[model samples]
Target: MAQHETSGFRSFIFSRSGMVLLGFLAVAGYFLWEEHAAHILGYLPLLLILGLCVGMHFFMHGSHGGDHGSHRDEPREDDR
Candidate 1:
């Protein structure tokens, strides 16, 4: 278990996305340390709006039209 955990950690540290995230956090930490909270806060709404728009775009079209049930809504001719 420890070995697996260590390997996963190593891979995350070496991965491009993970490295970018680490860099982002480091920069954010520096800004926060410099008391640039207001500057960062100014972009909060933009980020939130962008994130929600992206989430809605992906999820809104991801459905496969499966809401219709297996059985037909209309009665069969034999039922007449």
Candidate 2:
């Protein structure tokens, strides 16, 4: 019997449309959390936003610059 082909996480992460949609959702979530839930978070929106930005930055850009920290070393704009 032939094995079924499955992309699993790769399909979701590598899709251009998925990335664009995820980016939009991230921005929208940030705004909603900042404007609506800041008081609930003790007004730590700046910290949250900074942390999120840093995390995404590290995920998308860090490994591309010869950094051995990332698990998935996908190609970046510089390599194109």
Model 1 clash pairs are none
User: Which residue pairs overlap in candidate 2's backbone?
Assistant: none
Q: List where candidate 2 sits over 4 angstroms from the true fold.
A: 1-4, 42-80
lDDT, residue 65, candidate 2: 73
Every model: Cα RMSD to truth: 10.1, 20.4
lDDT of 2 by residue, 1-80 (tens): 99886687778866898899899999999998888884777758778999999999989886567646564577787789
lDDT of 2: 0.81
**lDDT of candidate 1 over 34-74, digit per residue (tens):** 79778778989999999999999889978757765655887
Clashes counted in candidate 2 amount to 0
